[model samples]
Target: MSESYDVSYPGVRVWCRDESGSSSLVVWRSQWTPEVIRIETPTIYNRTVWTVGQARVLRDVLDAAVRCAGGGSW
Candidate 1:
């Protein structure tokens, strides 16, 4: 199972997720147009764009990964 939450941000819909154990984050340009989602992983400093509806379904994989290597939260 996974847990997800929406974090408030101006002009954007930010989500955090933790799946099974691994974590990652997803951000949408806005709630009006959620077709595109940006996937970000802080651990490796990687970002990618996905357009599938599944992206929204998987938004619950963003968590812990947002934390810095030194145990700092982002």
Candidate 2:
């Protein structure tokens, strides 16, 4: 589903998950300065699976995004 940059969704986590040779990652709260610390994944994602923490963050971010887009957060 993500061989390249997915324009379908505009989020950093998703983007980071799909980037190539991206053995490590850092989820920024905002696109601002060097203020946020990054969380390292157990393994690099090749569009295959998600680590427990990664999956959790993904679900939460997607849910919030969906709600903010006007759909209910439930």
TM-score of 2: 0.34
Residues 1-74 of candidate 1: C-alpha lDDT, one tens digit per residue: 43455522332434445454555454544565566656555445657667767665554343434343344333
- Assess candidate 1 and give its TM-score to the true structure: 0.32
lDDT over C-alpha atoms for residue 38 of model 2: 38
lDDT of each: 0.50, 0.45
What TM-score do all the candidates reach, one by one? 0.32, 0.34
Clashes of each: 5, 0
Q: Tens digit of lDDT per residue, candidate 2, span 1-74? A: 32442212222352243344544343333234233323444354423334446657876997798878998623
lDDT for 66 (candidate 2): 80
- Residue 58, candidate 1: alpha-carbon lDDT: 57
lDDT of 2: 0.45
